[model samples]
Target chain A: MGGSSGMTITTARLLRAVTLVVLLIFLFRPETFEPMLALLVANNAPAIYNQGSLLSLTISHLAIAIAATAAAALISVGFAILVTRDFGREFLPLSRSVANIGQTFPPVAVLALAVPIVGFGTKPTLIALFLYALLPIFENALTGLTGLAPTVREAARGVGMTGFQRLLRVELPLAFPVILTGIRLAFVISLGTATIGSTVAAPTLGEVIIAGLLSSNTAFVLQGGIIVAALAVLSYDGLTALERLTARRTGRVATAV
Target chain B: MIASPRHKVLPALDKLGVFIAIGLLATLGFAPLMVFRANRIVLGETVDIAQAMPPGPMVVLLASIGVAGVAALLKTSAMMRLIASLAAIAVLAWVVGVSASFLVEGADAVARASPASGFWLLFGIFALMATDALTRMDPKPSLRIGLVLLAGLALAAFLASGIWDDLSVMREYENRAGSFAREARRHLFLAFGSLFMAALAGIPLGILCHQVRAVRGPVLSVLNIMQTVPSIALFGLLIAPLSWLSTELPILRAIGVSGIGAAPAFIALFFYSLLPVVANTVTGLAGIPANVSEAATGMGMTERQRLFSVKLPLAFPVILTGIRIVLVQNIGLATIAALIGGGGFGVFVFQGVGQTAMDLVLLGALPTVTLAFAAAVIMDALVDIMRPSGVQKGSQ
Candidate 1:
């Protein structure tokens, strides 16, 4: 106990302190970061996000992310339900391959390929994000649904519930937590990947990162990195919390709970 | 949707099939099959290739229409569906050759000829018909492989026939073939080199994290935080530190560590690989059943012997899954490395974007997509073969 007390600087505490410092540098005084850049760079150029407020960049980033994730969720979940049904059973392998096509596609290639067809800005980024997010959501939804206890589904059928009714009332609720896990994975990953959207004029936090890259400015990179990292951690935690909460509420999802 | 007594095949979507058939017929009848151009990439006066080209390939067109019509019938034979799809694909290949034949003949007068919207829609309908037919037949893997090989052979025959010389995309490829090959090789080098470095660093780091309880939490959290940083930002962040290293340490600079180029790209990719490798390693090691280790010990194996012989062998496949993910991901991220003069296929993509040349973009994109897809399939097959039994599914 004495030895433990002697060293009060725990790793967790250090991590917390470092995180706080990073946040302060990102949000308040980015000037504090310039010195580190000056130390690292020969031509330490100051990088800017835009002439406008950084808050707008943050919002635009979040907006695109949320919109794309939401769209992906809607389509992926529907497709999952479709492929799992008796009529759509034959499409199961094809669906898996198609969803994987999104993952196999590099978002950079998707972005480059998109610009010619979709033009610039949020449209292309959203398309890329939508494609990038599909695999996780689809795979997870399939797992969640397919992994259901046969007895529970049998009970649902025995209870005279129609296919749609069982999906809505029994299967979906049971699968909700696993589906949320997929959403969480997709959301956090998208938070990082959406930065690339700024390259195609999507006006995300990547704008700062790209600018910093071009100009050799470490401070701008830190500013952008800090925000994105924080956003990822926060969203990851928040989604996890939501998952746990829903798992608890849906007593059927006993494993995660 | 009802299944007839003689129709032994699965329930077919006759409505959708018929709709697509009608669409295919309309496309062939009304829309110009392919457009001819007088200059490269310039939208010249549109001439319908089907109407203007000699020997028309009318027989193939009529065959495609007949196949589509038969497949759309209420109770078509599975054999008929297979023939329809194969015919549709054959027609697609033939149409491209026939369209390019005119441009090839008038190579001096015509600089380019491209498939217009009609061709695209027709292709889509044919592809839809093909997929529908495939789902019906559910052909064996060997049969599917044969079909793919046959299609590839046909396309190669077309290209070797020199009939597509006036196609704009091919023209772009012709100009950049030398640099394209070089860039493709360098792109591969960067991906493989980065993965090698990642394994070198990550595998041991993972072992350390797994063995050392004190380091596990901090190491994992740090890597997690590292992963959350966007690739662009991480690459940007590395430049300054890397440049500093080069400037401050002359010996390091002598080895070609620099502010830009492959050094920073490799560093960033290394960071990206860490989370998966380390996490999977930790998971794999911790997941080892207690009895398995006890049996090794009971057999008089030392700690090193147990780890090497028992734990590692048990864990290798799971750890391999992580490496597979990293390898595919690295192939993709290497494209961004080109932006920093790291020399990859990305040069063409970015240059195309700059020039607003879509064909140039395809020259880069098509290969990158193929590389990524091939890496994924090959790795999946490798993992399956290495297991020999069956994969541990949800655990991965």
Candidate 2:
């Protein structure tokens, strides 16, 4: 923790606090920005999206993102753990390809395809988000588990730790930071992607943006974009800090995470 | 330690292969091979494989499935597994084509027949098995590149033969053949054009960041923040400003700049492309050995000469990797750009979604997947071929 520059941390915290305050104002009080929005658009165009509350839209957006990302993390991390074991090693190659190939799939296409099988609404969006979030978490978990020093494992064995005990106590702890980085990535991606759920009748911030687009209301578009971007940037910074703390605790040198 | 009796009794199984084979068998037995819709937007009825294909083609398909299954279950060599997998895929394609022809017989222009969940499942399983075999065999880089080209040729041939003309997605294509070509050209242009612009600006910025300690922190942080902004949001944010600019400035309007079109989308993609290119450039340059640079200095080469002749050459591969990442990323993002009238494959995707037509969605999606996959594979092979032999050896 001390290795990091104090000045950067201070500036980051300041930025975070400012963004939070501004977001709160935007969500709770649209009138504050309506004047500015009015200036941007013509007189006839609506300055704000009045059909849905911004706060509720933000909440629903977050709810879907969290649920999908949590589910993806659980399944993907479990699969990674399973395949790394001796009995499941034969599946390593297949699992790797599945994760890699899944990433190559565009999120928009995935969401679009899901509508055919599941029909429209939040169900398809959730399913798509889950599938989209799986790759990064799985890849990171596999890397974190497999990249353990062989000597560390031998040392644990020398100390008479059973396989389960060693895995629980040492492996999981050491891999936690890396796995958390994956979860952060997955969460950020899910947050952005869940905004597109509006196309399929899911109540999300995307509804605002899509509505704005259909009506050619630039104010509505800008408002939706601002809220979503704030959520992403703030959450990303918070997660990075958490990841760094965990890495420091585990004595792992953090690189770009 | 004595080995367990159960361990001795059980032969080691290729579990992934077995899993795929089981999925294949399950799909064959229970899932529908095709769907027949009375019209484009109607809910389709599932058609069984037995009802769709004639006995001769059915027998051939069954034989290929059996071969794939046997090769998967047995302790077969990689070559045998690869052959079985590819043959099974080919047979599956042929049978699907036959089934489409059979199903569409005497149907009106509005009628549609398309591969259902079962056919897709089989395709995915066989593709997985083939990939596994290829990975295990670890073919030479040149051979891998050749294989991708061969696959592309086979796809072209498949399309040219009109075997898939009766399929619903192909019908969607037939209806909009002109627009489909235009959108495809637009998609390629957006993807490649943005990449070219990004590389033009990014490489130099990357070098600047690497050389100047003061610029690195602020520049990278800004790029990181830009990256966190969703593509949709970025496009939206650009609309107001760009439109305002175009309205205020006649020169910009004359150049085709607009609020909610290609201009905003293009600019957003350029911003997204910068982080990867710049970061990779810095990394590649920083990776040069101190001794090598010192040697160049000792040879009395000017700073500019050392940079262009020595540092840039060493960093080329890594920079190329960054370009590959950006290209694949930009291709995927360009689809979303269609929402704001950027005009790419995404136009079909969003349109299909609005119309609730699955075939139209597939028509848009399948090509995007293929393009991204091909880009990744070609770039990977290029990276492998371009890497210095000594560096490759040392890394391994």
Candidate 3:
């Protein structure tokens, strides 16, 4: 009876967390408010909802952000696995070197190199975001895997489980929490880097800022920057909530209530 | 660790593979030369082999082949050997062809040519070298080969372009070498200077925030807010305040300080660096075991003494790590400072893009990338040295 009640409590908490994230998303959707404000400021306020270009731009930016972040997560996890196996220790320094290179190479530089070949667009922007997000994802995955208690792994192996079986059933489940944290970090980074995409003619929130800069329009710049900041903050808060929910689900967090 | 007959046989095979790869590259590299020679006959123009050829790409290709071939020849699986050999051959050929064209035909020709061609050539070479190096017993040799190839490329460019004789900034403008050298030096200087200022301001503030709980929350939140603001907007925000300051203050105006230059640029970069340094410092200090501090206190050490001797010594490594992050971030952001006359490598990058001068952009960008990498390595080395032996032993 107590266990069932506890599960119900957890479910409610998870739902609340989801609601918060959704709220954040809606807040950053410029079509939801930006156009209405622009209209009101330009002249008299209209009662009708305006489905402006801002909606399409926001959707495309979000899609690019998600796709790039997902790709970064996969590559980082694979690299982390390679770093943890029998021959993995020997490659630790090499792995760190590569990850360091990825982080140290500025996204703008990547954009410059990519522009001539990939020719400007969301594709080049996606590549830059992926590379930019690699370090944190890779580091977190490696840290999570290595931080696992050896005894738990040994016990699983002792129970007649094959290495692969033990890895999937025991190690990965245990490491999921940390890996999720990495994903969260990568997601936030992708969101920020997507703005730089606007420079290469890839339409994103950065377009607004760049347009503002060129025209010296502080109102437009403020509108764009504020929306970007709102997006970053909201996304960060969403990730934190997700992290908390994951911890609770995984029985990693000790809740008083 | 002793080398056996197997090792000797492997190295020999690797050497043979390298030679074959280099040979292929040289042949491919000369393909464009052949095309140029044939075209000259049709146009009734004499083909000058010395003028028509670029040996740099060929040399780099040859070097790559030699290194990769030796790696393949080692007593490895047939699959490893085949990949290494093929990669070496492909890379060499591509490098030779591309570099030859780039040297003989020039920048405009390269730009007008197929976009995919140069990328594939460069990508193939980089990939092949990476694979060959990774498979080696000692990766150092492969890295050395890469460095040597880079050096050869640099030397070739210098010799071919006559850049050495006309190294003067004024001379470049007169000779149409463009503003590559002068712009590169300015950007490099800004990157280093911005990094230095960020460190000086950030570290002490980080330490203060770490020591005082009262200031930590507000300081951290402000820093976090600053980071979320995009670079362009941050630069824009500074113009108003800085312009106002210059107008009000006679001293600032007299020094040629304006809204759009170094002063505003530096402030923006420094602001951006605050969060990482402060957050890391607080986290590092907080992470120090409570028992250690208690023990120091029990020993009758003063608060300042305990902080300096015990807590700081223990937390120094993590603190350094945070500083490293701040320094690297500052370097990258400093480039964007050029948008507002911060006058770094970004000037060239933005200007090149604006003017469609890929060469000028590359000149601006490549060194910044190299400098950032070098800074990261130097910081990593410093962190390694400062780390206690106990921590090192435990991590391994």
Candidate 4:
């Protein structure tokens, strides 16, 4: 019986494995020479380099993103601490409710409402990104802090550590790895959301693509898209590396259980 | 009966302050009209007739009545209070009959003056104050109250300001109506369709990946890669191939296949949906205890039976949760599809942005957001239904 189950599993995996390879091959393959060439030309180094406006816009987007991420992290960790403490159980449902509501309010709607008051540009975009990134960060921090073995916390308390001291030395240190994972997720999401800021004319990689779409310039669109994708991938991978390094350095890899 | 004098006085003062704050906010909200007068402007001018045509004192009187109604309701059931407040405001609105005037004036003003004038600074401050007052009332304030207050304020402001006189606002709506409808239909179709497709493709793959260690590494990596692709860029990447196909295939060309519409939008959204669906499915399936499957096998069940009856039933909730995530994400991302003409509410959004018409944009966006919220609520209900009753009981 086990053997048959194993075979079924293997067959399924093999099918997916093959399909994935085929997809990659298709994606990377140059299907149309002219379009591809056009895409390259539109995204050529000189045009991008000369576009000071685009470059500054991109910088501003990143700056705002960083600020938003920082805010999300602080709020999430604070909420996480509150929820994980003994006094926090009463507030768990409240925290979940907040997160649920946050998720439901689409960032675009937030942007629309904010534009009239904030008067466009980076501030509204930052607020939207911050709200959008809240749930994941909060969830991860809560789960990370709570998922720690009770015994470890108990041991810290038994040693005469105060509540704050216990949290800093034990709970936080242990939760850092999981919290980092959440940060990584939030970072990736924020990167994508920042592109939406382009609609408000806040400038980012999205400007190139939006311009391309409006003008029907396929090359410009593709080139801009490629760079954005590269940036996402680079950031995702970079965060993963940072997470792993932190995990290793803190020796949480061994104590994770 | 033996309450301290200080405590009694404090409650009275608190109530008094609430009333005062509400009144002050309402007065300040209408203060913008003091600077401007109602006057007609020729079409194509920057100054809108709406700005020129201020509401008469009658409208202001009605608004004050509405505000009083709202304040009174604040002490009772927040939900009932909100409804009462809204009813008062709506009644006031009908009494004033300024909506038509506002629309006409707003259009003229937008045509004549820069569209930005319609968005006065006081309008925002008033909205913020009203929202703050509503939210601060309770530990968990009624969403209904908040909505009613916002709608009441918006209607009151528009009527009072006389910003709606211009026919251009209506004309803009009508001109974009066809495109907007088409885009809306396209977005709804793609958002739901892509999610449905993701489930069909993702669940089986997830089951397989969980069962086979060898397949896990590559499958996970692919899923990760999909997740890492920023949404706009993903759509950008899709345009080239889809466009090529449109040209290469006669059927596609005849169908009016284009690079910037539904096809590319659907494709990009579909690709994005896969990662969450697949990841959730795998995680859910993998989490099922080993002994449960072992017992099913020992009972002489076939592999298919084991999956359907044993594994799937057990993993159903987790699978649904993944679907929930996909659905919510799709609703939000569907807006981006508007960038490519996939339509839905995004048509109004982008057009409004381009024209700088905040009202028209709000009309489109408010519904989109409401739809998303409704969708989320429905999905949450589904998950609740799918959850095993015993598990539900245990969780509680």
* Tens-digit lDDT track of model 3 for B220-279: 766776777777777766766788799999899999777777777777777776666666
Candidate 3: which stretches are off by over 4 Å?
A1-52, A86-92, A253-257, B1-60, B72-190, B289-300, B391-396
Mark the 10 consecutive residues where model 1 chain A has the least summed lDDT.
A1-10
DockQ of each: 0.44, 0.49, 0.28, 0.27
Q: What is candidate 4's CAPRI-style docking category based on DockQ?
A: acceptable
Candidate 2 displacement at residue B180 in angstroms? 0.6
The alpha-carbon RMSD values of the candidates against the true structure, listed in the order shown, are: 5.1, 2.9, 8.3, 8.4
Q: Estimate each model's TM-score.
A: 0.84, 0.95, 0.74, 0.71
Candidates' C-alpha lDDT: 0.76, 0.85, 0.63, 0.64
Error of 3 at A30 (Å): 6.5
Q: Model 4, range B1-396, lDDT digits (tens) per residue?
A: 776767665433233225435654564354332122222222233333234335563455446555644454244444444344445444433422343344344443433222333223323323333333444443222344345456557756864554443333443555567876776777789889999888888888888888887887677666666665567767766777887798889898788666778888887888888877777777677767888889999999999999998888877877887788788788878887777766767777777777666656765776677667767666666676677755321110
Greater-TM-score candidate between 2 and 4: 2
lDDT of 2 by residue, A118-172 (tens): 8788988898789888988898898889989999989999999998999899988
Kindly list the per-residue Cα lDDT of model 4 for residues A1-257, writing each as its tens digit.
Answer: 00123246567456545644543442344232344444444434332322445445556756777888889999989988887777665456656666766778777778876886687787778889899888888888887888888899899989999999998988898889888877877877787788778778676777777776666566656655655554566566557667778788777752211
Per-residue CA lDDT of candidate 2, range B265-300, in tens? 899999999988988888788878898999999999
* Ranking, lDDT, top scorer first: 2, 1, 4, 3
Off by over 4 Å in 2: A1-7, B1-12, B248-251, B390-396
i-RMS for every candidate (Å) is 6.9, 4.0, 8.7, 8.0
Best by TM-score: 2
Once model 1 is optimally superposed onto the true structure by TM-score, how far is the C-alpha of residue A237 displaced, in angstroms? Answer: 0.8
Name the better of 1 and 4 by TM-score.
Answer: 1
Residue B229, model 2, lDDT: 69
